[model samples]
Structure formats: structure tokens, C-alpha cells
Target: MAVSRRKFISGSGLVAASVAAFPHIARPADAAATRSGQKPSKIIHLVADGMSLATLSMADQLAHLSRKRGLAWLNLHRRAGAHHGLMDMRSLSSLVTDSSAASSSWGSGSRIVNGTVNILPDGRELTTLYELFGQAGWKRGLVTTTEITHATPAGFATKGLKREAAESIATQYLDRGVEVLLGGGRKFFDKTKRKDKRDVYTEYRVKDYALLNESADLAAAPLDKRWLGTFAASHLPFTVDHTHDTKLAKSIPTLAAMTQRALEKLARHERFILQVEGGRVDHGCHMNDAAAAFFDQIAFDEALEVCLEFQRQHADTLLVITTDHSTGNPGLNGTGLRYGLSPLLFSNLLEVKASFSEILKKLSPPEERDKKPEPVTDPAKIAAIIKEAIGYEITPRRAKLLVPFIKKEGEPIYNLMNTLTCQLGQLMANYTGVGWTSGAHTSDYVPISAIGPGAERFAGFIQNTDVFRHYTNLAGIDFRNPESPLVGAVSPDSGILSPHWMA
Candidate 1:
């Protein structure tokens, strides 16, 4: 079933969407954090990096986006159907937090300024939730489709001078020893890829741990607490290409694959905490690739499916699924290129890009080769497909630009076509009565859902900073330690974190 989006320009709503991700007010720390009425054997943090309300709601309504299966999160909640809740996801700084600040909000239980991690604007370095979990004798792991060093994952594992400081980010994970570190960003570990001539992977001194990057190597060195894997030269390719290059995606793992591996590894301990990040959902939204974005959301839905499955067996675990922030509101609007509603007319990104090239080739004259010429379109087929998809006929004149714009193959006549598609949801907004601004995060209160022990505490409207204390207070994770230096006091310009906090 297709998603229904009214796309209305509602007045100020969704606090997280408007206030930026900083704390306007500071509340007393909840004493219940450490010794709450309930405790879980495990903690699973499922994050969708740029997930907006519209994005998630639309995905949920699509019904078929998750490969014809129901959304992974929804199905799990329905089956176990225990803790339903909401989270106010603004960071301490900007309403539009880059993944780092947003991730740090939950990671540190305190919102630091935008562009900065948990360190305060003054000069203090706060310990992350995982650090607390580790100190409490619980195991920890991180799984992301993007590079582990990327903002969201790094928010949980490392904090430093800059979000761009991937080199240092890679080093932070080396000694801390998170049980399972799966994702892309192979460049950070390889000397050849880094601007600095240092290969951190080779220098990593953990003895006896298997640093495997290929499927074949997994048997040689199974994923263990002592292991760290980097599977791509860059962020792993879109999920569509995972099978094509297994080596890069092998130990790196999918959202589902890593979620399972983390659960399997961490489950050995009496208690464990895991953060599974669907990082590219935001990237796809940024790139304005609907097919890629939608599919990536599907992949995350699969990961949630796996997380929900684990929750079924381990009844005590607290499962919280939500986005750190939303990108442009991708609300679906009614279709406009309705050319007779043909199924073949609306292909995915690759297909659309390819089809446009093929359609143009069929129209171009052999003699027209090296010269700049007017864009041409084969409206006959284009019209038929449009009709199939939306039940309307597009003019051959309109097809001249629209078809090539949509297909975007090789040397095409349009520039910034992706931007156009991202706007499609917004343009249809007026007609559908839904409203959206261009590529930007809105200050809206994000939805937060929780299940299992203390999950009820997450419901009702709350502040973004309250979220930090919610779990920290639940787990009794402390940030204040005389041994630990004051946080956020250090200036960003100093190019260093306080001595006590290693970035």
C-alpha cells in the first residue's frame, strides 16, 4: 500500500524540529538512573540518523517499502507490544544537529553544543553511556552502515576536536576495545587513504584478536571483543551493491548483520549495550535519492526486525527505536508525471537513470554526436509508463525535459536533478496540503518509542536534555568524577580535548 501524506504546513510543532538540539533548561538529574525500579540484562539503541516524523510515518504507511513485509519495528512492537513511548530529539546546541551532536545526546546523556561533542562549550569532557556501561561490567558494541567513524557512531564511541577528525576517531576505538565495531570507513585505518602517513590498523596492538575484512577470513578469526573490522574504502556502497562487493561489506556487516553479531557477542555478558545506526538514511535523504533513501529505510526496518526478535527472547532488554534527527521532511505528495499509470514507467534510481539514457539514445541522431543540441524525448513510451503509474498522460513537450530529468543517465540535459526529486514531496505539499521547506532540519518534537523496563518513563512531551538523564539515570551512569576533568571548558580552537578525556 502507498503512504498517504497530507503534507500540510502545520504551525510550530515537533519541538525537536524547531529548537535545534541544545538544552534550553537544565533539570535535576534523576536519582533513579542507576538503581531504578527495573533493570535490563541488555540495552539496544536503534537509530535512524536523519529520520524525521514524516519520513518514518511515510515509511510505515507505505506498507510495502520493507520488501512487502511489515516495518521491522512495528511488527516487533505489535508482537511483544510492551513499552510504547516517545523521545524529544533536539540536541543541546542547534535544532539542526549534525549526526555527532544528536548521537552524543543519547551517548552522553547531555547535549553539548552543535559541532562539538559531549564536551561543554566552556571546557569539560563527559564520559559516554557506553563508557558507563563498560564500567558497570556490561559489554558494548557499535553497528552502522556508514563508516564507524561517522558522526552518529562516533557520538557513542569517541568525542573530540572535530566531527571531521576521523583519524583520531579511529585511534580512540583501538584501545577502548568495543566488542563489535562493524561498518565502513576503511580509509581511516589505512595509511594510503589518510592524509597523514599512518596506518592505524597495522599499529593496533591488541594481541590475538582477528582483524578480518573478508567473509572467507571470518572462520579464521570470528568476531570477538578483541576484534575491529573496516570493510570499505569509503562509506559502504548503497545496500543494493552489498552483494556485489562482499569483501567490503563482509565483516563490516549490514544493519541486520551487525545487529545480530553485536547481540550474539554481547549476549555472552550478563549485561550489554549496543547502538545500531542506520547512518545512510540521512545521506540518501540529503542526496535526494528517493529509491535509495526508501530502500535504506527498508534495510533499517530489517535491522529493527532483528532487534525486535532479540527482544522477544530477552524479555528484560530495553529497546528504543528512533532517529537522532530528521532531514528535509520527505512527505509524499500526489504524483504529477502521471503518464497513464504504467508500472515500468517508474523504476528505481538505477533503472530511472539508465532508462533515460536509453530513451535519449533511441532519439538522438548519429550525426548529432559531438555538438550541443536540444534535449529530445520519446514521449510515446514515456507517456505509456506515466499513465500506468499515475493514470495521466504527459505531453511529449514536457517529456523532453521530465524524462531525461528523471532518468539522469550519462551526459544528460539536466543538472541537480536529485534536488528536484527531494522537492517533489514538498511541491505536492500545497496540493496535498502538506508543507515542507527545502533541504533543512525543522525544529519539531521527534517521536520516541520505548519497550520494556522503565519504558513508560519515555512517554509524554519532554525536553531533549531530559533524554540524557533518562537512561543514564536508569542505568546509574555517572558523569561527575573528581578523577575526570571538567567537561566543555576547553576551547574548540585549542585543537585538543581536556587531558582527562582522550579524543
Candidate 2:
């Protein structure tokens, strides 16, 4: 259990700094045996979609800025408690990997073409690991702050059409009989909410099978998984917004709650695979809101705590924490902000855009309503709203910069806000001397930290596809048709194999 990589951490920097710091990670020893010789009975994969090295760095800086001690990923990395290693996250595209390809990399073990999931770059479809796990008799679950049917979770759970089909994904979870399905996105399940307006949840709850809308939900039996629930929609409310709305928060549990119930339900099977994603981290990062991103990661960190605690009780579990890709690549310049401001400490950029746009809409004269002062990008007006709702102020210069980017092409207000948020995190950092770049997904190998069975196999800079091989091999699943070159793994150790360590 002793860490061997501490001495290598000489100075502090981003990915480069830690790369040298932990040179030799302790390989987790092989897990216990079932009827066959395999790694372990449980594997929990925690994917923070769109988490770039910058996201990791921002999470740490945000935690430190907001409070004294920060999150465990930073705290544990700081002290080398968990298994820390880099994962080379390249897609078959090899340029930039979207969530579909990046998550598909993990889902299929082969890097698929950019826009598809579980299918190779050549359009060959592979059965997703979720189905594979189900067939293998292992309970599986997918949890997200976004719709449970979103790209990251759905990539593993089902396949069809494009990632755009949220309704179909919702049906997949129910049809697949996944033990736990938790997240936001009420619209897709509510048929009536659509122009089609089919209330899928009410239908499912009412057991009115005649009204089943999607292909997947037709034959669905009523689910009574004690520890699980599902909501069908695209995105969930932020923690800040959750406080104001009871229906949103009360209707669904937090990611931690889902994970806990998942462990409660799925762990009983003796072998299970669950993927918990803090999907909104990418959203917050996209907007450049450190506060929202930070807290969400904390919410994710809370899930991590639930997992780590659960791991302590169930040693056979291999808990792997990593990201599919990086977004916005936000960061601080190591100066300014006597205190570090976390990425989560952000105002809802969407709210500002909505409010500001509303003010603009009201401003147009009735006679000339069609014409809209190029829309007041006034920072003062923005500051008033943000200060009240989010407790932050924006200067006129920054507010003015927000207009052109947000209003053009009739873009969704959230997109414009997300764009400005990136600026906001950096701008806030400047008061104490912080700077950052605009949004761009980085092609960087995310940090893949593991802490149980088959974990040693994850060490070092391995290709994205390699993860598929190792996870399937350990979980008693199969790889896709296209065989990838084998990347070597670190030998297993006691920590991962310990009977009580369920990650």
C-alpha cells in the first residue's frame, strides 16, 4: 500500500509537472477468482466527460481558491494516495475526439470514428459494454447530471441513430433493464412535452403499455430497483438552481445518491459495472464558469467519496476515475487572485444571457420591434443580475465582448453564455492575476487514476483503445472485432486485490 512515486514530484506545473512526479505507480494485484480466473467481481468506471488536463488543473485551483483543502483528486494526487497515471485519449480521428468517440473508445475498447459510438472508424458496429455486461450477468448502471441517455452514458448503454436521439436512449435504459438510471432531462421521457408530447415517465409509471412511444420502451416491464430511478431529458439543473426548484432536485437524487443506491442494488449481484459521469463539468467549463464547474466536480467528488468508501467495504471493485476529453482548456497563469478561484465558482452564464437578452427584447420600440442597439452588452446590467443571483460582477469591457459572440446566427443563449463563462473564470482570476484562452477541446491524455482490481493494468501512457482491452479482459467481457495492438500493463498488487476494496 505504500506509495513509491512521491520523491519524483519536484516542482509544480500542469500535466508535465505530475508526469515526472509519479514515475512508477504500484500495479494492482490480480483480483479474486470466480468460477474462472479473472480480475474481480466489480468494476466501477467514473467518466468525467470533456475533462481536459486544464479541467483537472482548474478543479484543483478552484478548490484551493474557494476553501482550504480541495477535492480528493487533487488531495490524493497531492499525496499519491490513489493510483495516478496518464491515459492517452486519442480517437481513431487522431485530431480532436468528441464525447461520442472518446466515450466510444471506452465503450467498445476501439477508438471509433468521431461522430459515432461503439462503431469503428469504418462504420462497423460493436456491441456496447453495457449490453455485454448485461449478457455476462453483471448488473450495470449509468448516472449523469445530463440526461441518463446522453452521449457519455448512452455510448455504453445503447446504440442507434445518432447521439442526438435522447428519447431512444431513454428507452434503451428501460429496455436493457439497467438496475440504476439517474439524471435530468424530463422532456424526452415526457411525450407531451414534445411536439409529439408523449409522457413516457407517466406512461411507464402508469403502466399504460398502449401509449409506449419509442422502440425501446414498448415491452418494458415496471422497474422496481430499490436503489435506482430514471428521468428522461437532455440536461439537469445546476446545484445553484436546484436549491430554487424542488421539483427538479426532489424528482431525482444527486449523482452521489445514485451511486450509493447503485452500490446498494448492483453490488448485491457480486459482479457489476457502473459508469458515473459528472457530465455538467463540460457544460460549466464550456461557459468558463469555475464555480459551477468546481461545485459539480465537488458533487462528482462526493460521488468519488461514496465510491471510495464503498471501495473500502468491497475490495474486489476496481474504481477507475478519468475523463473522455478536455473542453475549453481553461486555466490560471500562476499569478494573481491572492486566492485561487475554482472553475465551479461561477455564475450561470445562461441566466445572464437570458436576462440581458430579455432586457434587449423589451428595449426595441414597438414600431421598430423587428430591429433589435446591437443589444446592450453592458457589463453594469450583467453585473447587477450576476451579483444578485451568482454574487459576482462583470466589467463593461467583458460584458460588451459577450454580445457579438452570443447573438450571432441566432445561437442558443446558453451557448453564448457558456462562451462568456470561460472568459468569466479567467477574468475573475485576473483580479488576483489570472488569464485563459477561449474554448477548445484539447487532444490530451486524461489522467486515469484507478484504485482496485486490474488497476495496475491502467498505469502509464496507454492508448484509448487499450482501456477497452484491459477493462473487458478484467470484467470477463469481449473486445470489438478489430483487434488492437496490446499495450503492456503494470502487474497487479494487494491494494486492488484486497477483498474489501470495492471501487
Candidate 3:
């Protein structure tokens, strides 16, 4: 099926501009020949975690404006033989699924509860796709912008009751013999940072894994051995910050670099399955940082380009690109009379230099002796900070509205939306023409784009749990995870509990 580009761009002028700017995106005559009727020997699953449809649209717009090209993922929609569809990402416990459950549904062929990885609510452990592939002698790999042990990657290989168990999850990756593990969470492997003081790094090294801690190491490292790399104590720096800081750019590899390296290492094996995640895109959405989210989405697209290039050379590979679920429902709103100013306002996103998290640190920098930094309540200072970081000038009155929340003086109205980050996101929307519905996951049908062998299996509407079956079938494996009787049980009236902030 030909994926539609109608929703991606409206005017013919913009389409022509996109094609002219990125002429290499045009499909080659041999592209159709790369699609195979036989089972795929390799699969590359790419996830832009927490990406809503609007997020993808805005990211494409941003890329056209800044990079002079449309995103590779969106470009795939224009390919004649590619498959495009929507996926229902609801979990067993709730309509709005978290990353763990969303990925678990795909990983285990079962709708597991939120906050859990590959374990049913009733405590039965589901066999994950990674374990099955490993049993069949296929090399496995995971790459992400978040901690390698984060929910999305962990959902594929580990069985745990809590997604927060990073240390345990890291250990599981080593035990499962996943050939390539890249991304952040240095604390999970460093003895000094772990709760139990166990050096998981040493364990990997002892097992002949090539441990990499810096971006430079990745280039020189041999691809013959198992690889484990961690570049941050927690999640890697947001793309916005990483782009601005030279030191960070040198230390941390981009998502595309990690994906390329992972594929090179895995390609050495006869068969392999790799999962690449732009995990921090979800973090950016949760924090309501438009530039952060969009740039990370672009970073995810760069990785998509790497996968596409690999598939062009390797016909037996299956490539499935999708998100776990939607978060924040961020969109560029129509601005001014008849929306004449919408494009101009949306273009202001180019001026954004830092994420809300980085801006907050500057606004409330810690004092000596670890004392909490006093909020910068001065409207002039606040306006100055906003102007410097976001390149938008706000009136003193508008700046003052953020004082109460920043100072923690009292709970503002609409407690959830009133967060300092959310308030900042709202304030910036006037200039950027971006707005967020809520800083939480939504029960929306996310888009799926697939190509190469078995790509047709993902076309049309499908449940999230069905992905596991498709993947297993493509790999010539037949196994069904035990289902919990409580599947589809309505969650208790917890009244929209705040997301586990760090997850």
C-alpha cells in the first residue's frame, strides 16, 4: 500500500521545495526489488517513544525550515510499496498506556499492566521476543536515547514487576547475552552509583563485552565482541541542549550514530534483531518542551535514515518504525486572524536554545551548601531569562504569572497543567504557536510505518499486542504468551495520577 503524504504537506510549493532540498529522498527504481516474499532474517524496530501524530507533523515542519529536508520517516510515506497504518496502544490496566505496558504489548504478545515489563498483572512472566530470538541463535541489540534499561528496551528482554529497576534490568541484558547495548544510565552499571554497589560494568567486561563510556570510543571499538555503552548517568542530554553544548556533543553520540554502530555490530551476525528508541522524545513531551521534543523526533528520523540505508543494501531485513503511544498531544495551533500568522509563529521554534529543564536550572540555580535556590520572582529577571533562552520577550505581567508556581508559594489552579514546566510551555506557545493538551500520555491511536519483508503485516488498524505475533511469524517462530484473565479490566478511579516523573 502506498502511504499518504496528503496529511504531511498541503501545498504543492512546499512539496516541490522538499523534493528540491532533499533530492536523494526520491525512491530508486530498485526499491521495489528490495521487498522480499520470504521471511526476514533481520528486523529493525524503531520507536519514537511518546510521539503523537501532531509531534511527527511539527517535527517535519521544523526539519524543512531548519535542515532543508523533510524527515526520512515522513518521506517513507511517499514510497509506493511502504505500509502505513495506525495502532491501538492501550494497555491491560488503562486506556492511556505508559511506555512499559505499550512496549510490553509488542514485546510479549500480551497486554500487560502499566509500570510492569513483560510480567502480567497476575504475576505470570511472558516470554519476550528477545529471549525467543536468542533461543533461535539470533543476535539481539537495543539502542535508545534514554537509559538502555528504560521501559521500552527492557520490555523486550526483561521480566520485572517494576520498570524502575534499572540495575536489575542492566544485569538481565548481560545475562540474556544481547550483543549490542548502547545509550545512557551509567549509574545502573557503576558500582559507586548502584544501590547495592555492584559493578555491572566489570561484569560485562569480565564476560568479554567491549565497554564504551564515551562517544569517541564507539568509532575505534572493534565490532567483533558484544558492546555495552553508557554516556550519561541518567537519560542522555536533550537534543536541544546537546546541540548547543560543544562538550556534550563530543561526549555523547547522536541517536543516528548509536543506531549505525549497533547495526554494524549486529550485521556481523548471520541474523539479528535490534530495537532503537528516541526515548528522550517522550521526556521532552512529558515536560512540554516543544523544541526538545521536535528536535529529538528529528534525531529519531536520522536513525530512521540509517535503518533505511541498511535496508536498501540488505533486502531480507524488515524495518518497522512506530511509537509506543502519544504523550502531551502537542500541536501547533492556528494563530492570529484566519491563521495568517500561524506559519510565522511556528517558525519562532527555531530560536529556542534550551529545554524547559535546562531553563529551570538557570532560573532557580542551587545555592551554596546544597540549599534550594530561590525562585527568580522578579518579572524583569524572568523576562530576561525567557528572552535569552527562548528568544521571545514576554510582558512583565505574563512573566509574573509563573512566580507562584516557581516559588512553590501555593498550588495554582489546574494543578496538573499549572506545573512550572507546563506554565512555561503555555507561555511560550504565544510565540511558537505550539500548545499541549496535558503533560501525560493519551489514549490515541499512534501511527505505524513499515517497509521491507512482511511490511504488509503491519498495514491497516491493528492492536498493539498483534505486533508480537507479526514479528514472531516473520521470524518463523510460533509461541503465545500466557494471557492474564484480568486483561481489559478497568483501572481504579485514581483520578489521573501523575506520570511516574522520571520514567
The candidate that wins on TM-score is 3
RMSD of each: 11.6, 12.5, 6.0
User: What is the TM-score of candidate 1?
Assistant: 0.70
Which tens-of-lDDT digit does each residue in 1-503 have in candidate 1? 22111111011122222222212223223211222357666788888877777767555654352234456566545543354555566555445566676777777766766666566656678787667777777777888888878888887767654677888888887666677777778889888888897878776634444565744443344534355666677675555344233353444456665566566666666677888888877765664444445556767777776665566556567888778777766655444466332222232222221111122344442346578554334667655553343234456655444544444443322332234343333222323233344455555667667776666676676655565577776676755421222243436575543221011
Better of 1 and 2 by TM-score: 2
Give the distance in Å from residue 214's predicted Cα in candidate 1 to where it truly belongs: 3.2
Predicted model with the maximum lDDT: 3
Which tens-of-lDDT digit does each residue in 434-477 have in candidate 2? 34444546677688887766777777787777777787788766
* True-structure Cα RMSD, model 3: 6.0
The Cα local distance difference test for each model comes to 0.58, 0.58, 0.83
* TM-score versus the correct structure, for each prediction: 0.70, 0.72, 0.91
- Tell me how far the alpha carbon of residue 123 in candidate 1 is from the true structure, in angstroms, after superposition: 2.8
Q: Which ranges of candidate 1 are over 4 A from the true structure?
A: 1-36, 61-66, 76-81, 205-208, 216-225, 241-252, 335-436, 480-503
